[model samples]
Target: MSMNDDDAEILAVARAGFLDEAQEMLRQFEQGLLVLEEDPSDSESLNAAFRAAHTIKGTAGMFGCDAVVSFTHEAETLLEALRSGSRQLDEDVVAALLESRDQIELLLGEVQSGEEDPGVKASSEALAARLRALLGATAAAAHAPAATAPSQAPATGALGEPEDGGGDGCWHLSLRFGHEALRNGLDPLAFLRYLATLGETRALRCQTEAIPNLDELDAEACYLGFELRFDSKAKREDIERVFEFALEDSDVQIFEPGTAPAAFEELATRRCGEDPKARAALFQCWHEMGMRFKVRLEVAAVTAAETEAETPQAIPHIERRVGPAEEGKTQKRSDRRSGEGERREGGRDRRAGDETRFVRVRADKLDKLIDLIGELVIAGSGAQMMAHQEASPLLVEATQRVMDLVQETRDGTLALRMVPIGETFGRFQRVVRDVSKQLGKEVDLVVTGGDTELDKSMVDSIADPLMHLVRNSMDHGLETQEGRIAAGKPPMGRLALNAYHDAGAVVIEVSDDGRGLARERILAKAVERGLIAEGQVLPDHEVWQLIFHAGFSTAEQVTDLSGRGVGMDVVKRNIEALRGSIALSSEVGRGTLTQIRLPLTLAMIDGFLTMVGGVNYVLPLSAVAECIDVPAECAAQNERISGTFDLRGEVLPWLDLARFYGISPDTSRRRSVVVVRDGQTRVGLIVDRLMGEHQTVIKPLSAIFQHLKALAGSTILGSGDVALLLDVSGLLNAAIRNGQQIRQTGTAAFAHAVLKS
Candidate 1:
């Protein structure tokens, strides 16, 4: 029949839904296959892998996605055999299955892109043949079976076919459609048609006794059921895959030939319908195959003794029994037992359910939400400003409450975009596996603090840089097994990815217990490249930093993995693009640790407000150690002497903000110093005034302001004035450098002044 517009629209929507589901199923399939590689005896993982392929095939059939259906059918065959313990799980089988999973994904992508290349077809067929070989099937004859309905011949015995039924043995399927199946864009007949491509359909029975009269029947309501006998060498999962998508709204049961009666009882109790005749018909059909179904009924007559045993209202009551065809009704027992069984099973499968419960949200949506929340934060600050200026008690009180609520909302919304960094870290597993094998090295990737959460956007942006670092560590930092043994270390090299929250920032460290950075070699390379002054005796930290200079490498020879002298500079640029900083620490014979520190959220933060030379600045509250009043003597002391101040007996290196930023200090102002720490290092920042705390919503600066590394971002204050949010770590580092310069100059100035005086 020619398709109508309505039919076309329905099919279009179904296809879209199928595409979305197919992607998720493919992900599960990949993850399950990876797990199977580690622990082949993991039954749940095996089942998950099988279910993913089975589900994709079943859904694809609904949309007439023959490519996906056919490819997945072959993979599902092997997964089923593994599921039933008929086939052993080994590295070869797992590798082939993984390849098959990829091929299925490629096929689904083709369906979406509407592109069919001959090369893709060839690759798919090759993978499918490999899978078929694992299953002991010949590729050429795999698609040769023809279907025949059982109505053409007498019903065979319980075994479905002959005892020696080489290729004709069939799997039995029972399908009962829910009333809304058609309304949900599902066609029961379409599934059977798709199933035919897998093998032969030997028998078909359509039960339509529940269809209403013409005047009462709803055209969209489905009242169809079918019992089909399908002939194929496919496993049980392959047969059930034919009806996978229909199971949600319909009751579907697949029975292999000679299935026991107890299995039927379990299936019957799981289904709910008002048609007793249909239930009896199902059993009668099974009885025809030499299976017995027992029915029990208890009835008692009303008696005076029974009435005396209880009140009349409480007396046992009986209704006359009628045959199913006459009454056309039956009571559906509550599925409490089945529900309990599910609950028990649920305990074992909670992880799968948890994974399904999570919704994959788009990154752009999160960005939009964060942008809106940032604006709300600025608006809230404006309201507070107006309330304070009005000097009305009620307005101030109301605005304070509003500000509190806004802060809470802002935090909660921002958290929606904070996912654990572990996901980004997990993707490197495949990379490490493949690259290690290629490099002829044995490396263990140990990850910690994966539970540490960071902004989702930042996490995504950092993945490439992190991958580069990990690859560098594996290739250069790690030594060969023989070299490692000679160095008196374990033969297997170790690479680690760790993350933690530190001083208001998320610190990610990638380290390896292998050959560390060769400082002398790096310095020499930097000198040869003119990246540094020749013969400069630099600190080890500065030497390590030279590795990040563009096109700088110490390797004398180039290799595919790491020697072309690129990547590290790009890694630094990428990390810094996220408003973050990277540092390196290495000991000659020990190991190298590359640390990255980034803001928890790029959008907003609680800030300690300070004024430097009449300019407002915000410091992240989490990094502020404490605030101290600068003594008049100390403020009035010589400018050079101001670098080091005795803070409760300990000498603290202080940076005068006005001098550091090239703004003249207001000498008459009462100076306060805010101590800030990055990790274990501390620096004192002297300001003209401490303006208490403020809510700081970070607005990223334009590319023109990219050179200002000391300023993390810009923010709008309560007075609607733009304030620069200070990068605490950057400021601390600068303070340390400036303090060193001042100490040298101060000594020289003191000596000259003493001689002149």
Candidate 2:
């Protein structure tokens, strides 16, 4: 059968949705497995893990991802055993399951890429063998029949043999499919075929009483129901899981082997509603079906009618059935139904509330929305700028109100992109587990402030850098069990990931309680690599930073992880590219904490605009401490590109933007210093004018300007002038290094002359 264009498109969309949902399920599965590994008695985690695998297998089957379905089925079977207490969880089982989880992910990836690798298939088979081994002989034997049989094969058990495991294993199921089942791509017959694979279908009956006449029939609407006797060893939950996808709109009832006849009578009444003719027709259908329970139907129906007459308030206009012995049971069922109705109503209300609270939107759509909002901010600024020039108070006021609303809108839209860092943090659990075992170390990962939120884009990009840091800590920073024990510390090492908002940036710290950086070893490596002079003396902070240089390491030997010295430099570059900074603090015999500070967002920011030497510049409003006039002493040294200024009792370094960027100064305007804080240090920026606050939409600099470290990006002003956005941290570091160079050689005169030119 060939699919048309519309059908193909719908299938593609559904497959994409499935892939996304499968990824989340994988995460949950890994998390549950990790929890169970710590405490095997955690039944909740075991069940959750089983369900995650079961869901993946079921949904993958629907899409015909045969590799994923086959691989996940193995894991699902093992999980089912653990869930049912048929097999006890052990370390070996947990390890195999974790590996199985990874294999399933690879299989799903193949499904997503629409390509298959023979190697993955080979690996899947090997892992499946391991999972089966974990299930032991009895479980493996129990699952062998279903595993080897064709999925749609009919059951072969004899219907007349009561001793052939049909007595207590027989389950009666009633199914009423929703009207839109056909449109939703669900076929009732397919479910029945799937059921046949589970066990023997002793008997089957189809009810067509709801089918309308041909003239009034809708081909797309389903008007069918099924009653069947199924004999299977599967639990009720397992049976229900078969119809999980359809349960949203379909009504499925499962009765155990010993269920009373009155229960069926009640089911018939509920299915038929309050119409007598409909009830009678349904009764006739049941009698004709010749199910196992038909022998007691007449007596049960009469007794139900009498019970209904005695208790008329239970169901209006419906004659009850069941005798005095079953009367109490019937009333209890009615009460249970009422309670269930209330709970269902409450569930609907809660779901409705959740629908209003959260919405799943595509990333591209959100990016487009943020882009439009950026343009609106620019347009609003332009309007406000023009209004002030018109010299009309009313026009200015209206424009100001519009700008305020635009600002609010911008903030709210950006907030939509803010996601908690916890999900990203949670991924490292598995990494830590696997790496620690490989490195022969005992490491505990402690995460704090996971609820802290940051831009979703940053969250995604930061994961790799964080991964490297974690691996580096586990492989290099944390000591092995023997080393730790000999060093008067506990055999177990501690690695912590912490995040918090400070000033206007998010700071993530990865700290490890292990042997800190070896200052002498790092210096020796730096000297050996010609990075610095052999005899040079530097502060601890500067010495620690030498490790970030490309291909710099103090390890005596190279290993599979970290010692190759390829990751730290890349980590630094990635963070710097995000307009962020990294700092390290370490103490001998204690630990090392690597801190990364990043901007809250990249698309837009609240900026303090300024102008120097006819060129406009913007500073992040969060980093701006205060604006003050340049002191007379500092102003006198106009030729100096960098100098110091005194504010109250403290002295802070100041950078002259005009001289620093080689722009001609506007001497006619009085210069002011914008005090900005970068970490613990404060730096003052000398500018010609303080232009107050502006909403800055950041546009990245072209490749030609990539070497310019002081300018983070550029933006357009309301007056249509191009303004450069300053990188405060980078600019301050550059100024300090330049000042140090001049001081080293005592070449103040040459430096001043060079600046003046």
Candidate 3:
């Protein structure tokens, strides 16, 4: 059927929501599988994994993503077997399930793209076959060992009859759809059709007693209920999951084949409310459907005036007689119902609290909000500037108060985008598991300080780089079990991911306890690649950095994992592209640690403004340790582009911005040194003037200026002039590199001479 524009739009939004929810489910699925692999006895994790897969399948079926539904069903079946204790959990089964998880992800991607890839389809089939084979193996092993057999006995019944008087050994289901179900794009018949795929529908009936008169009918509202008997080997949970997508407002009751009679009475009362006509109608329908029970209806007394009042009268009292055998079962059922009532009430309270506490917002909407906030900050700055220009105390004070509020708003808005990095860190559990297995190594990943928060955009960007580093650590840095044992270390290697906030930046460390970097081999590779001169002496730190050079590898032979020499350099580039820095440290016999430092956020920052010549530049205020007037001696040597300065008995390398970017020096303006720290290193920046602190809304530079050194981005100032934002890490690295070159070549004046020329 063709859809109208509004229907299409609603479907699009729903599809997007389904895709997002599917991704989260996939994460949980993978995490659960990992936990289960570690401890097969963890029933909670097994059930969680099963539910994730089941949810994805059910939701995908609703959206008509047949490929996803089909592929996930195969995995779901295997998970169900594991969950039901019909199949044993083993390494092979876990491996196949993990691979199936990956295939489902690919299937979901195909759904998102609205096209199916032949290759993915073939892969899905192969994985599905493998999962079936695992199930087949379980079946074959059933008779071999009592331990591997199904933990629960099969239901006792012939094909056509249950021993407990449940006709046809079929499950009975009562469904009353919500009023908005049809309007919400749900078709009652669609769920019925899906149920057919799970098993055979023995008998079905649709009740129309709830439908109002044509004059009162709402075309969009659903007023239908259904009763059916389904015969399937699938568990009750699986059948219940078929209706998961509509559970929010629908009333669905699933009865096992042997359910007692009182349950049916309760269902009847709930379905048919107080109206006498509706109650009579439902009773007649159930009787026609051959329900194993009877109802006696007695009319209520009413005055002629009450009957003529035009309002619908209350229903007559309906009573059912219970046999002794049924009465005891009814009492037990009542107690169970009491307990379930309490649990459901608690669940509802918790859900209500959660609904009030958290809101699901579109990412693009948040981005738009952030952009608007940035504009507000700029406008506030302009207003404050104008107020100060007026020189009226009252106006200045009012503007200042507004600016303070603006700053607070900016901070709070940005905090909304801050998410804990643990979510990203959690992804590596599967990576470490798979990569270690592929390499025939034993490695345990330890994650610490995962609650450290950073910008969501940054978290997304950093994942790829972190993945590369993690894989590299497993493939290259961590030695095999035999190698570790030979070195007197534990047979299992340890790879740790740690994150924490350091000086307004997030510091992420990936460290391994295995064979560390070999300095001599790295130096030789550098010389062979002509990246460094032969026989040149350099510090250990400098040698460790050679691995980051493009296409640099010290491995004698290439492997599937790392020896291609293509990852580390790209990792470095990606980190730097985020205006972040990467540093490496290693001990010969110990292990290697690679640390990445990134700004807390990229959209806006508290900046310390400075002027070089006639142009304004901003430095991240968090990086500014202190600002000092250039001493007379250093100020006299203004001709030098780069030099060292003494601060509190320590000498620090300093860069003159005017000369570094080739801008003409403004000798008339007194110079000041702004000391900024990047990681553990500190550098002093020489600028023409300090313009105090400002709220800087960062705007990206044009592609043409992307390669421009030390300029991170551009921002507009209060006076409507563009100010360049400095990349503190990049500037410090440049100054330190220049200092190293000068010391090596005895050309401390080389940079100054180049500027002069």
The candidate, 1 or 2, that scores higher on TM-score is: 2
Q: Could you give candidate 1's per-residue lDDT for residues 1-757 as a string of tens digits?
A: 5457788887776687688888778778877887788798898988998888878887887778888888887888778778766678997898898788778878888998989978889998888878888876433343323433342222333333332111224556767788988887889888888888677766677877679999999987999988666666555545555665555456666665543333444455444243333444555554443332233211133344543443222212233333454223121211211223353245437645876888656568877887888888889889888988999999999999998899888999989989899978877776787688788898888989999999888998999999999999988889999999999999989999999998779999999998899887887788778877988776665678788888888887788889888999999878776767888989876889999989898888999998887899999899899998885545766374335556676655666777767788776867888988766556677888999899888888888997764888889886778899998667654544444544645444322322222
Those runs of model 2 whose alpha carbons end farther than 4 Å from true positions after fitting are: 1-7, 141-169, 182-197, 200-209, 213-215, 258-261, 272-293, 296-350, 737-757
Q: Native-vs-model 2 lDDT?
A: 0.79
Clash pairs for candidate 1? 150-202, 150-203
Q: Is candidate 1 or candidate 3 better by TM-score?
A: 3
Q: Residues 1-757, candidate 3, lDDT per residue (tens digit)?
A: 4457778888888889899999999999999999998899999999899889988888888877878888887888787778667888999999999998889899999888888889999999888888888888655343121122222332332222232224445677878887989887787887887676577776788978789999999977999989887766666666767886666556777877656545666656566655544555665565545444433442354344543352222322335455776667655544332324453356557777988998888999999999999999999999999998999999999999999999999999999999999999999999999888889998889999999999999999999999999998898899988888899999999999999999999999999987899988998889989988999987776788788888999888899887978988999999998999998989977999999999999999999999998999999999999998986656766677666656677766677788777789777867788888877777777899999999999999999988777789999987899999999878755644655433432134333322222
Give candidate 3 misplaced runs (Cα > 4 Å). 1-3, 137-166, 183-185, 273-280, 287-320, 323-347, 736-757
lDDT of 2 by residue, 519-611 (tens): 999999999999889899877777888999998888888998868889899999999889999989898889999999999999999999999
Q: What's model 2's lDDT at 393?
A: 100
Best-fitting candidate, scored by TM-score: 3
Model 1 per-residue lDDT at 656: 73
Q: Report the alpha-carbon TM-score of model 1 versus the true structure.
A: 0.78
Q: Each candidate's TM vs. the true structure? A: 0.78, 0.87, 0.89
